[model samples]
Target chain A: MSFRLALQESPGNPWFSWRYVQDNSDTILAALREHAILTAEAMLIATAVAVPLAVVAYWYRPLTGPILALSGVLYTIPSLALLAFVAPYVGTTNPGSVLIALVLYALLLIVRNSLAGLNQVPPEARDAAQGMGYGRWGRLFRIDLPLALPGIVTGLRLATVSTVALVTVGALIGHGGLGDLILTGFRNNFYKAEILTGAVLCVVLALVLDLLLAMAGRLLTPWSRRAVR
Target chain B: MRSENPIQQALTWLNDPLNWTNPGGILDRLGEHLWISAAAVALGCVVAWPIGMWLGHAGRGGSLVVLISNLTLAIPTIALLTILPLTFLGFGKPPVVVALAVFAVPPLLANAYTGVRSIDPEARDAARGMGLSGWQVLGRVELPLAVPYLAAGFRTASVQVVATAALASFVNGGGLGQIISAGFGLGISVGGGQILAGGFLVALLAMLVEAVLAVVERVVTPKPLRKARGRAARRAAVATGSA
Candidate 1:
């Protein structure tokens, strides 16, 4: 309550003016929190759906084309257009509209990467698993998924980063993460502090999340680095 | 009796001839969207392609590519555009162009680097053995070999940019997003039509880019390499099927 956005927007102030931090600390933090939460939620949901769809597509080869094609076409739709297109159907106020679009954007990356990761498991590895009496589901989870971890993580990283960026576009639909601050500033005669703060927070958030994901990828697949050494 | 569906209402409005002929009509919006996307892609190539080729040729700075790519992903372009006006860059097309250009770079860089790196070592050696300079080797051998990847990269970058260029409207850069944004203000029944028209154009732009690039990819891939690559792919498909 005390930390509402700063009242005085210094448009003439330098972009990096210290005044932004002094004035709009609360708004910046709130936007950051919202952005992070939405992005994370979207990625998690995308992964949940995409990974399984990819698995099914891999299992049934004929499905791959249709499955990937759907996402590919969806990917071409502009973020703004998609938001507006859905706004009528879902009600403009529904955050689900934005979340749904973000999820769609993430799907192609997630599915394609998951498939690539699964494909990366050498045939011999699969043979070894089968020979070792691993059942189908057991082998998929234990052998295939672990081996594909690096690839899947790569997809997740890509999707997460893009989602983080696109989530800002959601501001147009009333659910824009840090995008709201930027839009707020833009609408209110270019409130420089809000715009600058929003932009900086988004970049910082993307970098931090990207790094964290990379580290997580490394941790998940420790042996990936070993082959080089 | 006609349905008062918002989408239908919008379509009816879209049918008006005024939209097609006016100064701020659909055709103008289409032109703006195309120019913005094209400019972004062209500038992106100028900046990113050479860096990628250099990294690929050197076979170094792998981590540098990763960091740059991450930075590209992390920067929220729409937000960045809003901030740019306050900086020395000032407002309008410059900021929009810069943001879109930055967004377009990563794919080009990554693909160019990878395309070169994926060249056959034996082929590279033969080029060198034939008295080719490093640049000659790159131009004569690696460039042709990398055609498919380059096309693929361009296709991806262009498609994404075209879609993203819709955001230029937010900054008054003027593109198909104007229709969508305008539609939002016009309300559900009437505005929905404008939004649909804009989205349709943007999506069409992406699909067109993809289709053209796919054709170029097929045509420019060195014939022998394409045949060999095709065979290898078929073999892999067979193997996957059997497995």
Candidate 2:
């Protein structure tokens, strides 16, 4: 059937339409793919930055307050405003702008959680590790990091989920993956099918990512699970 | 304007005295932004706080709190803002308020539940032993102790509401976002200044609200709790040094 004929078969402004889904599956998948990739890239970079920053803060207690306060200030800036501010420097159409903004937004949770996790490492564990002749770096890897894994993972999960949600706002700059579809659907006569599809997929992506991270956290910290039993 | 640096252009736009006094000026938009944020956060408190407190007091609905927090994380604010106006709610402030209220609920609810749940069991027992009714225990003892958590929640909700309310302009709901959106409409080269100015205003407002609420949080927290926290911090410092 011709595209025009297929369009006519759908009722006016239905919230969902099988026809629309079938006809636009390629477009929908592309948007979803972009959204997922963007989120993953942003999270990867953010984790890399946050872990080291948090480690430094943990090592030098004096820097802890300022590090956290800076992230806290960054977190408070509205996503739209942050994006706008970044857009001028990076160019609006560049996905780099979104990636940079997302990373900044993710820093607070990951850094806070990382520091908290490090602090939670029992002092006795550190002392014991040191007594066993482990170097400072070796002790951090073997004793402290493993103990702090759960808290750090929790921060990653929170950051990933929020980044997924915020990525849609990147549509304002023309690169918001699923966000582009949602905004387009809104602008184009309130196309309910497209809008609902975009919204539902964003949530599903978030839920799926969160569950995967939680499971990964469990697997990475098997001793914690064993202790519960 | 094109010859000038973007920062210079933005400053010029911001400096325009006429922009302040004219209808739909910065002051007008700021008032709208504040009103919309306050209404949504107030509505959220009215709906979520009681439920959170009640469930927390009973020590039930732990899973529900988890569910709500996850849902809040998953749902995009932009999607909610756009979708609500399409429903029977139609356009304008009502849908914006509803959407923002939904946005505000999770932090408020989660914090409230956590605040109540964090209360020491011994405190509850002691209050009960002293002949306080269940309601009295919740009101006089539990609530007072939970003030810090509640205040933290309020601070979070308020700051978030203020930020997300900027999205209300998407549905023709009034707010400072109009400035940003309008600038976007004017194209980047021409409207760059306006966009920058809008971003600065929104960020400043959010930080101001956060700072103000933080003070409120400190003031509301009982003195004993404050002193105890300070002591704990000092102890932590000593322990860290020893380690």
In the order shown, the chain A TM-scores of the predictions are 0.91, 0.93
Q: Is the docking of candidate 2 incorrect, acceptable, medium or high quality?
A: acceptable
Best by lDDT: 2
Tens digits of per-residue lDDT, candidate 1, A1-229, equal 1211332344464556677787877877788888999999899999999999989888899998899788767777777777876777776667888898888888988888788888879999999999999998999999999998887887887788789888998887668889998898888876766787788788888778878998998888888888636
Report the C-alpha lDDT of model 2 over B61-81, residue by residue, as the tens digit. 978877777778778988998
- Using TM-score, give the best candidate's number: 2
Against the true structure, what is each candidate's TM-score? Answer: 0.88, 0.92
DockQ class, candidate 1: acceptable
Which window of 10 residues has the lowest lDDT sum in candidate 2 chain A? Answer: A1-10
lDDT of each: 0.77, 0.84
